[model samples]
Target: MQCHQTSFTLSTAGRGPLRLTARVAECVRDSGIHTGLCHVFCQHTSASLLITENADPAVLRDLEGHLTRAVPDGDPRYTHDQEGPDDMSAHIRSILTGSGLTVPIRQGRLALGTWQGLFLWEHRAQGHARTLVVTCFGTAAS
Candidate 1:
């Protein structure tokens, strides 16, 4: 059994999904783990990760729109406004979405559906550099 870990940083523009499928594939390919699992974790409370359709731009737009409506910022019920109106809202969105994603690896590549793609969902209204830690573990071909 072999285990490899790596990380990447994303500078988000705020409030949307940024596809990172290719980047992760590169890591998996370089890890030399022919068959394994790829676990990507977001190291932030206001951001999240997801594996959703990457073929259509509208899909991402609609998903973002739905999340915004479901957890709109500046809500009167939220009291954790230390970071701004979007602080609590961001945390809520992150919880609703996810903080990490796990994908299967085969032949040193991600075994994802054709339309499925990894994405970093930024919940804040302002941009921030988010870091993601990726861990790959499995047996290497001899």
Candidate 2:
């Protein structure tokens, strides 16, 4: 078995999901692990990771809309707004989603569905830099 890990920084434009499938796939390819699990983790509390549809932009919009309705910023109900009204809301959104993801890898590639895409969801109102760590572990190619 072999293990490979790497980290990269991404700049988010604001509060939204940014596609990461290709970037993560690059890591998988670099790892040279033919079969096993790929673990992706975001080292932040105000952002998250998820697998969602890549075919339609409307789906992403709807997801953002849902999150906006479910966790509105400046709701006057949160107290941890040191970084602005979106502070606590961002944290909530991250918790609601997640900070890590695990995907299967086969034949030295991600085994994602045809329309499946990996994304990093930024929950803040302002743009910020986020870091992601990807670890690929399993058998090495012969």
Candidate 3:
């Protein structure tokens, strides 16, 4: 069995989902893991990972809208607002979602559905650089 790990950095514009399937595929291609499980993790507490539709922009927009409504910034009831209104809310959103995802790798490519894509969900209001770690574990083809 072989294990390969790589990290990529993405600069998010704001509160939204950033598609990263292509980047992750490139990493998997470079890793030379033909068949295995690829674990993608976001090394942040305010952001999360998700696998959703990539064929349409409306799907992402709807998800963002729903999250916004579910966790509004200021409610006057949050006491952990020392970092700003979005601080605690961002953490809460991350908790509600997730921080990592594992996808199958086949033929040196991610085994995602036709419309499925990996995304980094940025819950914060400001633009920032986010890091994602991609780890591939499997047996190399002979």
Candidate 4:
């Protein structure tokens, strides 16, 4: 068995989902792990990871809209507002979603459906650099 790890930083433009499938695939290819499981994780409490539809931009827009409606910012009911309205809401959104995703790799490619893509969901209102870690684990061909 072989294990390889890599990471990349993405500078997001405020709150939204940033597609990272291509970047992750690049890392997997570089890792030399032909057949394995790839784990993608976002190292942040105010962000999350998701595998969503990549075929349409409307899907992402609708998802963001739903999340906003589900967990509205500036609710005034939240106690942790040190960083302003978007602070606690960001944390809540992250909690509702997740920070990690696992995908299977076959023939040196991600075994994802044609319309599925991995995304880094940034819940914060301000743009910032987000770190994504990609780890590959599997058996290296003899």
lDDT of each: 0.94, 0.97, 0.92, 0.92
Please report, as a residue range, the 10-residue window in candidate 4 with the lowest summed lDDT.
133-142
Single out the weakest 10-residue window by summed lDDT for candidate 2.
75-84
Q: Please report the TM-score between candidate 4 and the true structure.
A: 0.97
Residue 15 lDDT in model 2? 96
Q: Taking the candidates one at a time, how many backbone clashes does each contain? A: 0, 0, 0, 0
TM-score each candidate: 0.98, 0.99, 0.97, 0.97
The predicted structure with the larger lDDT, 2 or 3, is 2
Q: What clash pairs does model 2 have?
A: none
TM-score of 1: 0.98
Q: How do the residues 1-142 of candidate 3 rate in per-residue lDDT, one tens digit apiece? A: 9999999889999899998988999989989999999999999999999999999999999998999999999768788888789988999999999999999999889999998999999999997799999999997777
Least accurate 10 contiguous residues by lDDT in model 3: 74-83
- Identify the candidate with maximal lDDT: 2
RMSD in Å for all candidates: 0.6, 0.6, 0.8, 0.9
lDDT score for residue 102 of model 3: 99
Error of 2 at 76 (Å): 1.2
Model 3 lDDT on a 0 to 1 scale: 0.92
lDDT of 4 by residue, 3-93 (tens): 9998889999999999899899998888888899999989999999999999999999999999999999999799998988999999999
**What lDDT tens digits, residue by residue, belong to model 2 across residues 1-142?**
8999999999999999999999999999999999999999999999999999999999999999999999999989898999999999999999999999999999999999999999999999888999999999999888
